[model samples]
Target: MTLDAPHAASRPTTSDELRAIALEQFASVGFAGTSLQQIADAAGFSKSSVLYHFASKEALLQDVITPAIDQLEVMLDRFAGASDPAKGRARFVDDFIDFLLRYRLEVHTFINQGQSLRGIPVIDRAGRLIVRLSETLCDETASTEDRLRLGIALGGAAYTLVAGATFFEDEIAPADEIRTALLTVVTELLAPVTVATGPRTDRNQKA
Candidate 1:
């Protein structure tokens, strides 16, 4: 992996270059294991120069995480704007599939190496962005209970699709197919529907 550089050897400066370097290092090496020096070196910059732009490695990860989160919000917001639940549900899976494919390393970092992710404290916001997205969409249509249940069921689809890849790729065979199937199920779960009565549990338990 290379370290981030100030500019690409006379090339114009842009966010893309730095972000590319970060993604490269992150993908080749786990986020927890990757260092600012490596990213800077990869981008052809000094370590301090990289720190000047990003402040720290954690900040760099935030830069990476921000896009996935933003993309998710935009998908949900656009779906809500579309005013079609079916389209919204399909969009949800499509968006999540892209996010999972693009950020395989980061997803692993989040699910497997949260402690090293620096700042924003994982426990507080592991799924906060998606949760907020769910609330926003649900408040519009799904009943409170259905929202809670479906959001969980569908969100599990996204997380499990990614996680199942890492944990079961060999056993699953043609992991991409499994991921697609997972996304399909997730999309179906997201569609507005009548849920049957189910068991209830105490709300006080902190998950």
Candidate 2:
């Protein structure tokens, strides 16, 4: 899924153009498998021209996923300071789904890149976002068991998004309904527990 080359005397390739082509290549062939030559060919530019804008393949990848990661961080910050927790939660769910869809290939790029970006600031930011989200799913009163469950639920949500993308090539947006269903499940799981009957056991005590 590469774009056609610009006609003769067309403007020189912009950084944005290189990034876009690199993103498509990385998402398609994976970061490890993609090469600068591929990106240059796809964008109809010399390899050195691609290098002119980006220092290396890793730098280009960092640019590719940085926007999505930045958006995630902004969403987390907004939700953290939101005045109405209920509305915030609902809105965050909707926006998060939107982000996942808008950056479907970008998300795939990051996932397929594996640990190549390890220790990078982008990865740190993403990790912090996940932790914040896990804490958001629980509260000060939430038990350790409850927190663990919340983490599992969030992981399940990510897995479902990737799986849905793999299964439905032409219908990425429609697959968000899967997240909506998973959100319902998360709400139920995060709700406060109530003991309905009988004496509480040792397991319950620990929980």
- Highest lDDT among the candidates is held by which one? 2
Candidate 1 ranges with C-alpha deviation above 4 Å: 1-53, 107-128, 136-166, 169-176, 191-207
Off by over 4 Å in 2: 1-13, 111-116, 139-166, 169-207
Candidate 2 clashes between residue pairs 3 or more apart in a chain or in different chains: none
- How good is model 2 by TM-score? 0.65
lDDT tens readout by residue for model 1, 96-185: 667666665555445444555536553235566556767755655455566866656544543554456466764454668766776776
- lDDT score, residue 179, model 1? 67
lDDT of candidates 1 onward, in order: 0.63, 0.70
96-136: candidate 2 lDDT, tens digit per residue: 76776677667665544445756666655666666677777
